[model samples]
Target: MNQFNRQHIGKRIAALRAAHGDSLRQAAARTGVSHTTVGRLEAGQFGTSLNSTLRKIAEGYGVTVEYLLTGRDPQHDFESSLRRLPPEERNRLYFASPVTRIRMLLQFLMAEYPAEFPLDRLAARLGMSPESLRRLVEGCDDRQFTPEEVRRLGEQLAKVTSIPLHWFLSGDSGELAAAIPPEMLGAYVRLIKKAAEAGVRPDLLEMAIDLLILKHREMPAGSQNGRRGG
Candidate 1:
């Protein structure tokens, strides 16, 4: 069935804006709608019926109207949203609630099998019926999960997908943070937060900094690696 839900659309709009670091006023400017209208849109204060104004909103968010309305093209839509948001924000959106984690997991699967074949393929991967997956996209929760449920789901998903279980549990990237000494994790994230302000990619920045440390350690003690070029 091809349909949209008011509140679900509103949440996607709001999440996209946050992902883009957009204020309501910025979103309004992009969409050529008033800030108040944009606010109402995020609040899902409209009917599920798609219209011109809604089209403008979708275009402004750099997503197709259909993507917002029907949860199609989730590869482009969800990837852009996740990539544009910083790690901390990504963590919140994915790990905010048990339901959010499930939805995020769905996006992960959709990225693999997006477009025409996603529904049946993804349903198989996640071990759910197609109707069940559709309910999830439509904001219905079959599990009605709590935190404990989220933990168990995270474990199950990690086993199936090989994604780190800690990602679904903790806000930090456990792999990279583990590569760094535990004592330095806080400082590393602080640096990353600062670098993010300057538009440096956090993962890249961490790796580059790690390489520098590795270079220093591999150099002989009191070697010219530490000396200033003359």
Candidate 2:
């Protein structure tokens, strides 16, 4: 790409990183690139031949390579506007329980394109019977979706709604976790669960939990969070 295009891609990368709540180091780790490389990419200072690196970054962010290079994905404009919302509001919408967010997204698609997305037609498009789709949306016990079923739904949702497939499967939590080192994410989730069990106020603990994860990540592998090796 030319310098102008390179800079534009860099800006898109930065935006994607921010929207996913990832720092440069975290993004680098996730993409298997060095932290300095990620910093350089965000600053538009990459060498010629960035195609491989760009693909890796795009994969890390659960975005298409075209979206990263051209910012022209179907969801690009909508996701950009979402990123501009106050963090609290964005978090509330994105971090809602998976079922709730999926329902909200369905409602949004239905309302936004009522003529195009009537229930039976939408169900047919999803390769499901209308009653099955209804049960899925209504969370009926008889129609509970298996993980594979959810994955299939996510793929169809991505096609129809222009939302990322992960949004349908894991909501915002999956996006955030994708930005973190995979090895660390499990520990972070455990910590969050423990904090909740201990009666820590979730809103207040949010920042603390993130800080703790960052700190723990810096420790040598196999070391505990705070304890030093003998």
CA shift of 208, model 2, Å: 9.6
**Candidate 2, superposed: residue stretches over 4 Å from native:** 1-89, 139-143, 172-230
Number of the predicted model whose TM-score against the real structure is largest:
2
Which lDDT values do the candidates have, in the order given?
0.64, 0.68
lDDT at position 225, candidate 1 = 37
Candidate 1: worst 10 consecutive residues by lDDT?
Answer: 170-179
What would the per-residue lDDT of candidate 1 be over residues 1-230, giving only the tens digit for each residue? 23467778888888888999989899888888778877887787874444777778766766655566655654454456678886656533432554555567676666554653377865675566898778776677535656776676677555444456665675432345445544334555567668879999757976776885576457675563345232
Each candidate: RMSD: 14.3, 16.4
Show the colliding residue pairs in model 1: none
